[model samples]
Target: MASSTVNRWLRPEVYPLFAAVGVAVGICGFQLVRNICTNPEVRVTKENRAAGVLDNFDEGEKYSQHFVRRFVRNKSPEIMPSINSFFSDPKL
Candidate 1:
Protein backbone atom coordinates (compact mmCIF):
# COMPACT_ATOMS: atom_id res chain seq x y z
CA MET A 1 0.00 0.00 0.00
CA ALA A 2 2.83 2.46 0.93
CA SER A 3 4.73 1.62 -2.24
CA SER A 4 1.67 2.24 -4.36
CA THR A 5 1.08 5.63 -2.70
CA VAL A 6 4.67 6.72 -3.39
CA ASN A 7 4.49 5.60 -6.99
CA ARG A 8 1.29 7.57 -7.53
CA TRP A 9 2.42 10.94 -6.16
CA LEU A 10 6.16 10.81 -6.84
CA ARG A 11 6.15 11.97 -10.46
CA PRO A 12 3.71 14.86 -10.04
CA GLU A 13 4.91 16.14 -6.67
CA VAL A 14 8.60 16.03 -7.62
CA TYR A 15 8.16 18.48 -10.52
CA PRO A 16 7.40 21.54 -8.37
CA LEU A 17 10.69 21.02 -6.55
CA PHE A 18 12.51 20.92 -9.89
CA ALA A 19 10.85 24.12 -11.03
CA ALA A 20 11.67 25.86 -7.74
CA VAL A 21 15.32 24.81 -8.07
CA GLY A 22 15.51 26.01 -11.67
CA VAL A 23 14.11 29.43 -10.81
CA ALA A 24 16.51 29.79 -7.89
CA VAL A 25 19.49 28.92 -10.10
CA GLY A 26 18.45 31.29 -12.89
CA ILE A 27 18.05 34.23 -10.47
CA CYS A 28 21.47 33.61 -8.90
CA GLY A 29 23.19 33.35 -12.27
CA PHE A 30 21.63 36.58 -13.49
CA GLN A 31 22.75 38.48 -10.39
CA LEU A 32 26.32 37.30 -10.80
CA VAL A 33 26.54 38.41 -14.43
CA ARG A 34 24.92 41.74 -13.59
CA ASN A 35 27.45 42.48 -10.87
CA ILE A 36 30.39 41.56 -13.08
CA CYS A 37 29.21 43.80 -15.90
CA THR A 38 28.77 46.83 -13.61
CA ASN A 39 32.20 46.60 -12.00
CA PRO A 40 34.74 48.61 -14.01
CA GLU A 41 37.70 47.55 -11.91
CA VAL A 42 37.39 43.95 -13.09
CA ARG A 43 36.88 44.78 -16.74
CA VAL A 44 37.14 41.77 -19.06
CA THR A 45 39.21 42.43 -22.16
CA LYS A 46 41.93 40.72 -24.15
CA GLU A 47 44.27 43.69 -23.56
CA ASN A 48 43.84 43.40 -19.78
CA ARG A 49 44.82 39.73 -19.85
CA ALA A 50 47.93 40.41 -21.88
CA ALA A 51 49.09 43.14 -19.48
CA GLY A 52 48.24 41.27 -16.25
CA VAL A 53 48.02 43.16 -12.91
CA LEU A 54 50.07 46.05 -14.23
CA ASP A 55 47.20 47.29 -16.41
CA ASN A 56 44.14 46.83 -14.23
CA PHE A 57 43.91 44.92 -10.92
CA ASP A 58 46.62 46.93 -9.14
CA GLU A 59 45.19 50.34 -9.86
CA GLY A 60 45.03 50.82 -6.03
CA GLU A 61 41.33 50.02 -6.04
CA LYS A 62 39.61 48.26 -3.17
CA TYR A 63 38.20 44.76 -3.95
CA SER A 64 40.67 44.40 -6.80
CA GLN A 65 40.62 40.85 -8.14
CA HIS A 66 44.00 39.20 -8.56
CA PHE A 67 43.29 35.66 -7.39
CA VAL A 68 39.82 35.15 -8.87
CA ARG A 69 40.56 31.68 -10.21
CA ARG A 70 41.85 30.47 -6.84
CA PHE A 71 38.94 32.13 -4.99
CA VAL A 72 36.29 30.44 -7.14
CA ARG A 73 37.90 26.99 -6.85
CA ASN A 74 37.47 26.85 -3.06
CA LYS A 75 33.74 26.02 -2.64
CA SER A 76 33.63 25.46 1.14
CA PRO A 77 32.19 28.48 3.00
CA GLU A 78 34.18 27.86 6.19
CA ILE A 79 37.35 27.85 4.14
CA MET A 80 36.19 30.73 1.94
CA PRO A 81 36.59 33.39 4.63
CA SER A 82 40.17 32.29 5.14
CA ILE A 83 40.73 32.55 1.39
CA ASN A 84 39.40 36.12 1.44
CA SER A 85 41.57 37.07 4.41
CA PHE A 86 44.63 35.52 2.78
CA PHE A 87 44.04 37.38 -0.47
CA SER A 88 43.23 40.67 1.29
CA ASP A 89 46.41 40.57 3.32
CA PRO A 90 48.95 43.16 2.09
CA LYS A 91 51.68 40.59 2.55
CA LEU A 92 50.43 38.64 -0.46
Candidate 2:
Protein backbone atom coordinates (compact mmCIF):
# COMPACT_ATOMS: atom_id res chain seq x y z
CA MET A 1 0.00 0.00 0.00
CA ALA A 2 2.81 2.42 0.91
CA SER A 3 4.70 1.49 -2.28
CA SER A 4 1.65 2.29 -4.40
CA THR A 5 1.23 5.62 -2.68
CA VAL A 6 4.85 6.48 -3.23
CA ASN A 7 4.60 5.51 -6.90
CA ARG A 8 1.59 7.75 -7.33
CA TRP A 9 3.46 10.67 -5.78
CA LEU A 10 6.50 10.06 -8.04
CA ARG A 11 4.53 10.42 -11.28
CA PRO A 12 5.74 12.98 -13.87
CA GLU A 13 2.57 15.06 -13.64
CA VAL A 14 3.37 15.77 -9.97
CA TYR A 15 6.89 17.07 -10.69
CA PRO A 16 5.84 20.65 -11.40
CA LEU A 17 3.79 20.79 -8.20
CA PHE A 18 6.78 19.50 -6.24
CA ALA A 19 9.12 21.99 -7.89
CA ALA A 20 6.76 24.90 -7.20
CA VAL A 21 6.32 23.87 -3.56
CA GLY A 22 10.08 23.44 -3.12
CA VAL A 23 10.83 26.85 -4.60
CA ALA A 24 8.20 28.54 -2.42
CA VAL A 25 9.52 26.82 0.72
CA GLY A 26 13.13 27.64 -0.18
CA ILE A 27 12.34 31.34 -0.73
CA CYS A 28 10.38 31.55 2.53
CA GLY A 29 13.24 29.86 4.44
CA PHE A 30 15.87 32.12 2.86
CA GLN A 31 13.90 35.26 3.69
CA LEU A 32 13.28 34.08 7.27
CA VAL A 33 16.99 33.44 7.80
CA ARG A 34 17.97 36.72 6.18
CA ASN A 35 15.53 38.67 8.39
CA ILE A 36 16.77 36.88 11.52
CA CYS A 37 20.38 37.67 10.63
CA THR A 38 19.93 41.26 9.45
CA ASN A 39 16.80 42.84 11.00
CA PRO A 40 17.73 45.28 13.80
CA GLU A 41 14.67 44.33 15.89
CA VAL A 42 15.96 40.75 16.29
CA ARG A 43 18.49 41.34 19.07
CA VAL A 44 20.17 38.14 20.33
CA THR A 45 22.85 39.27 22.77
CA LYS A 46 22.39 40.97 26.14
CA GLU A 47 24.27 44.03 24.88
CA ASN A 48 22.11 44.20 21.82
CA ARG A 49 18.98 43.84 23.91
CA ALA A 50 20.10 46.77 26.01
CA ALA A 51 20.74 49.02 23.01
CA GLY A 52 19.31 52.57 23.22
CA VAL A 53 17.24 54.53 20.70
CA LEU A 54 20.37 56.02 19.13
CA ASP A 55 21.86 52.52 18.78
CA ASN A 56 18.63 51.34 17.20
CA PHE A 57 18.84 54.19 14.69
CA ASP A 58 22.43 53.26 13.88
CA GLU A 59 21.52 49.60 13.48
CA GLY A 60 18.62 50.57 11.22
CA GLU A 61 20.96 52.68 9.10
CA LYS A 62 23.33 49.73 8.77
CA TYR A 63 20.43 47.42 7.96
CA SER A 64 19.37 49.76 5.14
CA GLN A 65 22.84 49.25 3.61
CA HIS A 66 22.09 45.57 2.89
CA PHE A 67 23.16 44.78 -0.69
CA VAL A 68 19.71 43.70 -1.90
CA ARG A 69 18.21 47.03 -0.84
CA ARG A 70 21.01 48.96 -2.55
CA PHE A 71 20.62 46.99 -5.77
CA VAL A 72 16.82 47.41 -5.82
CA ARG A 73 17.06 51.07 -4.90
CA ASN A 74 19.23 51.75 -7.95
CA LYS A 75 16.99 49.81 -10.35
CA SER A 76 14.52 51.47 -12.76
CA PRO A 77 10.90 51.32 -11.58
CA GLU A 78 9.85 49.56 -14.80
CA ILE A 79 9.97 45.79 -14.25
CA MET A 80 9.32 44.58 -17.84
CA PRO A 81 11.01 47.03 -20.17
CA SER A 82 10.81 44.88 -23.29
CA ILE A 83 7.09 44.17 -22.99
CA ASN A 84 6.46 47.81 -22.15
CA SER A 85 8.48 49.06 -25.12
CA PHE A 86 6.79 46.57 -27.46
CA PHE A 87 3.35 47.76 -26.38
CA SER A 88 4.27 51.44 -26.25
CA ASP A 89 5.81 51.66 -29.75
CA PRO A 90 3.74 54.03 -31.92
CA LYS A 91 4.44 51.93 -34.99
CA LEU A 92 2.73 48.92 -33.48
Candidate 3:
Protein backbone atom coordinates (compact mmCIF):
# COMPACT_ATOMS: atom_id res chain seq x y z
CA MET A 1 0.00 0.00 0.00
CA ALA A 2 2.76 2.42 0.98
CA SER A 3 4.81 1.53 -2.11
CA SER A 4 1.80 2.12 -4.35
CA THR A 5 1.19 5.51 -2.79
CA VAL A 6 4.87 6.42 -3.23
CA ASN A 7 4.77 5.37 -6.87
CA ARG A 8 1.70 7.51 -7.46
CA TRP A 9 3.44 10.59 -6.04
CA LEU A 10 6.63 9.88 -8.02
CA ARG A 11 4.98 10.63 -11.35
CA PRO A 12 6.60 13.23 -13.65
CA GLU A 13 3.61 15.54 -13.27
CA VAL A 14 4.36 15.78 -9.54
CA TYR A 15 8.09 16.38 -9.99
CA PRO A 16 7.82 20.16 -10.34
CA LEU A 17 5.70 20.43 -7.21
CA PHE A 18 8.23 18.32 -5.32
CA ALA A 19 11.10 20.42 -6.62
CA ALA A 20 9.35 23.65 -5.59
CA VAL A 21 8.59 22.29 -2.14
CA GLY A 22 12.16 21.05 -1.76
CA VAL A 23 13.61 24.42 -2.71
CA ALA A 24 11.29 26.24 -0.32
CA VAL A 25 12.19 23.89 2.51
CA GLY A 26 15.90 24.24 1.76
CA ILE A 27 15.73 28.05 1.75
CA CYS A 28 13.73 28.12 4.99
CA GLY A 29 16.20 25.74 6.63
CA PHE A 30 19.16 27.82 5.54
CA GLN A 31 17.64 31.03 6.84
CA LEU A 32 16.67 29.40 10.13
CA VAL A 33 20.22 28.10 10.65
CA ARG A 34 21.83 31.36 9.57
CA ASN A 35 19.71 33.38 11.97
CA ILE A 36 20.32 31.00 14.84
CA CYS A 37 24.07 31.03 14.26
CA THR A 38 24.53 34.71 13.43
CA ASN A 39 21.78 36.80 14.99
CA PRO A 40 23.21 38.27 18.17
CA GLU A 41 19.92 38.55 20.03
CA VAL A 42 19.08 34.87 19.52
CA ARG A 43 22.57 33.36 19.72
CA VAL A 44 23.97 32.87 23.21
CA THR A 45 27.15 31.11 24.17
CA LYS A 46 29.09 30.70 27.41
CA GLU A 47 31.76 33.09 26.14
CA ASN A 48 29.17 35.74 25.31
CA ARG A 49 27.25 35.29 28.56
CA ALA A 50 30.34 35.17 30.77
CA ALA A 51 31.79 38.21 29.04
CA GLY A 52 28.59 40.16 29.84
CA VAL A 53 28.36 41.29 26.24
CA LEU A 54 24.95 41.30 24.64
CA ASP A 55 26.48 41.70 21.23
CA ASN A 56 29.83 40.38 20.03
CA PHE A 57 30.98 43.25 17.88
CA ASP A 58 34.14 41.66 16.49
CA GLU A 59 32.50 38.34 15.77
CA GLY A 60 29.57 40.03 14.11
CA GLU A 61 31.89 42.06 11.94
CA LYS A 62 33.87 38.98 11.00
CA TYR A 63 30.73 37.00 10.17
CA SER A 64 29.39 39.83 8.05
CA GLN A 65 32.31 39.38 5.68
CA HIS A 66 31.86 35.62 5.35
CA PHE A 67 31.49 34.40 1.73
CA VAL A 68 27.90 33.19 2.11
CA ARG A 69 26.87 36.35 3.92
CA ARG A 70 28.51 38.51 1.27
CA PHE A 71 26.85 36.60 -1.53
CA VAL A 72 23.40 36.78 0.06
CA ARG A 73 23.86 40.43 0.94
CA ASN A 74 24.81 41.38 -2.62
CA LYS A 75 22.29 39.20 -4.40
CA SER A 76 19.42 40.94 -6.15
CA PRO A 77 16.08 40.93 -4.38
CA GLU A 78 14.23 39.60 -7.45
CA ILE A 79 13.64 35.84 -7.55
CA MET A 80 13.23 35.68 -11.35
CA PRO A 81 15.10 38.67 -12.70
CA SER A 82 15.09 37.62 -16.35
CA ILE A 83 11.34 37.04 -16.45
CA ASN A 84 10.73 40.24 -14.54
CA SER A 85 12.87 42.25 -16.93
CA PHE A 86 11.27 40.69 -19.98
CA PHE A 87 7.77 41.53 -18.82
CA SER A 88 8.67 45.03 -17.62
CA ASP A 89 10.56 46.07 -20.73
CA PRO A 90 8.90 49.12 -22.30
CA LYS A 91 9.74 47.84 -25.77
CA LEU A 92 7.84 44.56 -25.23
Candidate 4:
Protein backbone atom coordinates (compact mmCIF):
# COMPACT_ATOMS: atom_id res chain seq x y z
CA MET A 1 0.00 0.00 0.00
CA ALA A 2 2.78 2.45 0.91
CA SER A 3 4.71 1.59 -2.28
CA SER A 4 1.64 2.24 -4.42
CA THR A 5 1.21 5.65 -2.77
CA VAL A 6 4.89 6.52 -3.39
CA ASN A 7 4.58 5.53 -7.03
CA ARG A 8 1.48 7.64 -7.48
CA TRP A 9 3.24 10.74 -6.02
CA LEU A 10 6.34 10.24 -8.21
CA ARG A 11 4.52 9.47 -11.47
CA PRO A 12 2.59 12.73 -11.74
CA GLU A 13 5.50 15.17 -11.08
CA VAL A 14 8.29 13.86 -13.38
CA TYR A 15 6.88 14.90 -16.77
CA PRO A 16 6.31 18.54 -15.72
CA LEU A 17 9.92 18.92 -14.56
CA PHE A 18 11.18 17.46 -17.86
CA ALA A 19 8.93 19.81 -19.87
CA ALA A 20 10.15 22.90 -17.95
CA VAL A 21 13.82 22.00 -18.51
CA GLY A 22 13.18 21.36 -22.20
CA VAL A 23 11.52 24.78 -22.62
CA ALA A 24 14.41 26.57 -20.86
CA VAL A 25 17.06 24.85 -23.00
CA GLY A 26 15.11 25.58 -26.19
CA ILE A 27 14.94 29.33 -25.30
CA CYS A 28 18.68 29.49 -24.51
CA GLY A 29 19.57 27.73 -27.77
CA PHE A 30 17.37 30.12 -29.78
CA GLN A 31 19.02 33.17 -28.17
CA LEU A 32 22.50 31.73 -28.76
CA VAL A 33 21.76 31.31 -32.48
CA ARG A 34 20.35 34.83 -32.63
CA ASN A 35 23.43 36.46 -31.10
CA ILE A 36 25.78 34.41 -33.30
CA CYS A 37 24.07 35.57 -36.48
CA THR A 38 24.09 39.32 -35.55
CA ASN A 39 27.52 40.92 -36.04
CA PRO A 40 28.60 43.52 -33.49
CA GLU A 41 30.21 45.83 -36.06
CA VAL A 42 27.13 45.72 -38.23
CA ARG A 43 24.94 46.60 -35.26
CA VAL A 44 27.18 49.47 -34.18
CA THR A 45 27.40 50.82 -37.73
CA LYS A 46 23.66 50.78 -38.05
CA GLU A 47 23.19 52.87 -34.89
CA ASN A 48 26.01 55.06 -33.50
CA ARG A 49 28.77 54.84 -36.16
CA ALA A 50 27.38 57.68 -38.21
CA ALA A 51 27.28 59.98 -35.19
CA GLY A 52 30.96 59.25 -34.52
CA VAL A 53 31.97 60.53 -37.97
CA LEU A 54 34.43 63.43 -38.40
CA ASP A 55 31.82 66.19 -37.99
CA ASN A 56 30.86 64.97 -34.49
CA PHE A 57 34.31 64.01 -33.29
CA ASP A 58 35.61 65.92 -30.25
CA GLU A 59 32.22 67.71 -29.99
CA GLY A 60 31.83 66.98 -26.32
CA GLU A 61 35.32 68.26 -25.53
CA LYS A 62 34.71 71.45 -27.51
CA TYR A 63 31.38 72.04 -25.78
CA SER A 64 33.08 71.48 -22.40
CA GLN A 65 35.67 74.12 -23.25
CA HIS A 66 32.94 76.56 -24.33
CA PHE A 67 31.07 75.92 -21.08
CA VAL A 68 34.23 76.59 -19.03
CA ARG A 69 34.82 79.87 -20.86
CA ARG A 70 31.22 81.01 -20.30
CA PHE A 71 31.34 80.04 -16.63
CA VAL A 72 34.61 81.93 -16.05
CA ARG A 73 33.34 84.97 -17.90
CA ASN A 74 30.22 85.04 -15.75
CA LYS A 75 32.21 84.68 -12.50
CA SER A 76 33.67 88.21 -12.62
CA PRO A 77 31.73 91.00 -10.78
CA GLU A 78 32.24 93.49 -13.63
CA ILE A 79 30.04 91.45 -15.98
CA MET A 80 26.99 92.88 -14.22
CA PRO A 81 27.30 95.99 -12.06
CA SER A 82 23.64 95.65 -10.97
CA ILE A 83 24.38 92.30 -9.32
CA ASN A 84 27.10 93.89 -7.18
CA SER A 85 24.90 96.90 -6.47
CA PHE A 86 22.11 94.66 -5.19
CA PHE A 87 24.44 92.88 -2.74
CA SER A 88 26.71 95.76 -1.81
CA ASP A 89 26.75 97.24 1.74
CA PRO A 90 23.54 99.33 2.09
CA LYS A 91 25.41 101.79 4.43
CA LEU A 92 27.61 102.92 1.51
lDDT of each: 0.68, 0.85, 0.81, 0.64
Local lDDT at 19 for model 3: 96
Residue by residue across 1-92, what tens digits does model 3's lDDT show? Answer: 99999999989999999999999999999988988888665636766657654556877787668887677896889999999988998893
C-alpha TM-scores of all predictions:
0.37, 0.74, 0.54, 0.32
Please, what are the lDDT tens digits per residue for candidate 1 over residues 42-67?
55878865765554444434344436
Candidate 2 Cα misplacement greater than 4 A, ranges: 50-54
What local lDDT score does residue 17 receive in model 3, on the 0 to 100 scale? 100
Ranking by lDDT: 2, 3, 1, 4
Q: Give the TM-score of candidate 3.
A: 0.54
lDDT of 4 at 17: 88
Candidates 1 and 3, the one with greater lDDT: 3
TM-score of predicted model 4? 0.32
- Cα displacement (angstroms), candidate 3, residue 58, comes to 7.9
Candidate that beats the other on TM-score, 2 or 3, i.e. the better one: 2
The Cα RMSD in angstroms, rounded to one decimal, for candidate 4 relative to the true structure is 19.1
Q: How many collisions between residues are there in candidate 2?
A: 0
As for candidate 1, its clashing pairs are: none
RMSD of each: 12.7, 2.6, 4.8, 19.1
Q: Which is the winner by lDDT between candidate 1 and candidate 4?
A: 1
Per-residue CA lDDT of candidate 2, range 11-81, in tens? 99999999999999999999899788888788668897788544568778887787788878977779898
